[model samples]
Target: MRTQLSIPVTALAVIALAACGAESGPGSGSGGGTVQPDVPVAGVHWTVDSLTVDGTRTEAPDGAHVEITDKGRARGNYGCNHFGADVSVEGDTVTVRPAEMTEMACGEKVQNFEDALRAALTGRLKAELTDGRLILTTEKGDSIALTSQQPAPLVGTKWVVNGLVLGDTAASLPAGAQDKAYLTFGKDGSVRGSLGCNRFTGTAEISEDSIAFGRLASTRKLCDGPEMDVERKLVKVLEGTATYELNHRSLTLTGPDGEGIAAVAAEIPGEK
Candidate 1:
């Protein structure tokens, strides 16, 4: 759910309230009002509960969400599309400015839900943090409700490729390629994966913001058609330095220049 910015009066009011120290509850002294604790929006993955547009209630489509990073980058699944944008938060006011998104087509119901979400998130919205929920309401009465949850870490996790970036577009693997590509990162800085045909292993350099793989060694197995093409591309991506973003059970790995891959967490044999 991403769009361009338009700060509404309600958002302005939130900024003013924060600036004036007009807390939501009573207190005294320099801290004359009881200040509500700031909601930890960054680093936490939020799952969508419901979306209301122009006073009409609508349920969020499956896998809908919005995640904001401390660095102001935002990424989410808007029911029918995957989007990334820049988000700024001042006081209780939050704004999402569009960047890039996948242009995948979907059914009418999903498209409608995505449209509503885009409208609600675009421009400036009044934000409220209560209990464990974060609500964003527009001046026009459109709103989105989300529940926060801890995100899964990338290190020492197994992931299976779901989609790959070709040039500027992202698309799912060709038919018959499902579950054939996967990668497992070890605590010892090693990574091993199946490239849909042969198994490969390599060392990886990981940091807070990026990852680069060292030389990789693989089995000499022959594959034809789509699987072979997938293997070649997957190995190329691994060989390049890629920036990664993780949200809950999903991971997106993009090269410094644009190419990348998207994957979902894979369950270990004994893990719950």
Candidate 2:
């Protein structure tokens, strides 16, 4: 199985914390017959819930998550930058080697949290799974809490464009247009959203792995240079059929020539 762990920190201040061992409370562990000690931990989207170190606990950020695969590979984001590591699972114990992390600069608070998380995840840890939750406890009693999450559906999801894909690389959107471009696909073969500066409505023919866009009508609006640039790129990709790859919460739409946009599922009100 190929596994990955993506960690992320939030705006929450990274205050000093402690090490509290994870106790298998009621309904946890394999003590009860209902608890399966050998549950498969691979290929599950484990959303980080919190981190308890020494004795203090901190809630995880929205995008904090981890996943492991059967291929001995672990990859994930640390709230800001992505990272990967080698891991081994034996019986109920999971051993995580020191991770190779990306050096993207983050805010002081997030950086501090990442440092602390990196330290806690290295070396051998006891793995416990029960009721769709997984806890990995380090030898020093530090533990990370995570819950399983179902993959987001493609339709009816608010996919906000986060980056532009060129060839095999993905680049961030212009600063001014960072969170402006978004799209929502409807069940009625309709698509609508802002192109960073203009609101566009169009017909989308959805196939098993591709989207054939029909005539897209957009409101005529003039915007700043950055916004216009974003709008142009988005329109180009949505002009024709594009292959799409959906990985958990992330989506990549690539046009025929290999240029496209990378989007992520946005949280919707009243939906989990």
Candidate 3:
């Protein structure tokens, strides 16, 4: 995700965005009314409910993630690399920071997915951060939304993985399989983690409000450690539950009914 712009627009985003779905942007999202195509400004997050990438229209968890920080501090993940960009916000006028990213190769269509997402975030976007949720939008009614849910406080806490849904189908990690999953939420939304295995990141949108998730990203090292079973079972469990609750030292996950499941993860030191 290294973006050293030769300038802005066209050159940098155009090519990068092309790899993302059928759209090409590296486009811009923070521009004015007269802002040209694929150019953006900084510090403005628009609010649109639905969006279409390339020719596909995705609701629910298939939306966007945007951030316009206070200290030129902006960062987000477009279902891909956690991105860091420069930004400037003035009244209602918004501008984009010179955006850049870290280079971590992933097997999922993450690299391509990011390119398309960045491209669509162009032209005078209007955004709102309400109740801790950040929603930014595009002219075509496209949108990127994010909720600030960080790692929950660890220490004496119990948790569980309920279910895992990839797209629409219910994917089970199986009972005998050593897999595991966890739930993390923010005022904005929720992120069901796949431990160290394949984890999916998605949110529920206006009408397309359904649970969404993705694959896991971790070090490519093969080990037969005990955590390996936790990783495997965690994934299976996530695909079973629809929702969960976390307490000081416990996590309870409700599956298709009130009789769901729960687990107490040994809160890692400093896992807040």
Candidate 4:
């Protein structure tokens, strides 16, 4: 003979409830379901929609955006200034340390936007991505809403130097030297450009966030004192460049010792 043991209906129901609760323990969804994965924030370009500080919300001025790469680097335009910094992400929290930015003067409105943006990014913030939008909320209740978009391409674009890094400082081109310093990257990995006073050609090796110029050949024509000085510094910095970042229409080249160049996109012929 065989004996069958059956559990009571109430006890079985309790057991089922316990198992369900275990599956949706701490950090689970509101309905006691599995926790959703953290939203991906890296390697995406974001355009600012609104930035709220304290309790007041302000629309982002033109040209305000942020791009965070998978390599833990962040670069953006703060309406008036271009900035870059190292970004660290852990779970749903992101921390963007104080960034280095160009000191371009802007109107009062743009300046205020920059000030608020800089303050918002100074420390850690809770990050949430929903409906293709990124929301960064600081512990103090400041929030920035950004819409994700495709970033501008870097290759096959002409760039005009707007500022150059000399030692530890960034300086704009000489007063009369607009559009004189430029760089163009060809489809064949060749770089041709003017170093303010002389035409230069070189082989450039470019990777996902980096660029290195090989032995460069340039015209030997001599120029004025200021132009020559600009050429000398430009050549040195280009030769030493190890990495590059492109944000909107701006390009930043960084060298081994924190030296770099900042350039804006130049309108080139036959290119839309």
Highest lDDT model number:
2
Name the candidate, 1 or 4, with the larger TM-score value.
Answer: 1
95 Cα displacement, candidate 4 (Å): 26
Better of 1 and 3 by TM-score: 1
Q: Best candidate, TM-score-wise?
A: 2
Per-candidate TM-score against the hidden true structure: 0.53, 0.69, 0.38, 0.48
Q: Rank the candidates by lDDT, best first.
A: 2, 1, 4, 3
TM-score of 2: 0.69
Ranking by TM-score: 2, 1, 4, 3
Whole-model Cα lDDT of every candidate shown, in order: 0.68, 0.69, 0.40, 0.65
TM-score of structure candidate 1: 0.53
RMSD of model 4 against the true structure: 15.5
After superposition, the stretches of candidate 2 with alpha carbons farther than 4 Å from their true spots are 1-40, 49-64, 76-84, 89-93, 98-119, 139-143, 174-176, 267-271
How far out, in Å, is residue 250 in model 3? 18
Q: lDDT (0-100) at residue 111 of candidate 1?
A: 67
Q: lDDT tens string, model 1, 94-211?
A: 6666557667655566667766676676777777666667677877778878776555567766788867774556666676776689898887999998998999999888888788
Candidate 2 lDDT, 141-233, residue by residue in tens: 998887777777888889998778888665666667777999999899999999999999999999989999999999999997889998998
Model 4, span 1-272: residue lDDT tens: 11111101111122222333346655554565753322344555567778899899999865566665544456666654666665545545655544467676555666687678667765567766556666777889998787765544566778887666644466555655656888888878899999988999998888988987898999999888667777776787778446887776678787777777777665544545
What residue pairs clash in candidate 4, if any at all? none
Which of the two candidates, 3 or 4, achieves a greater TM-score against the reference? 4
Off by over 4 Å in 1: 1-44, 48-64, 68-75, 78-80, 83-101, 105-148, 247-249, 255-257, 268-271
Once model 1 is optimally superposed onto the true structure by TM-score, how far is the C-alpha of residue 8 displaced, in angstroms? 17
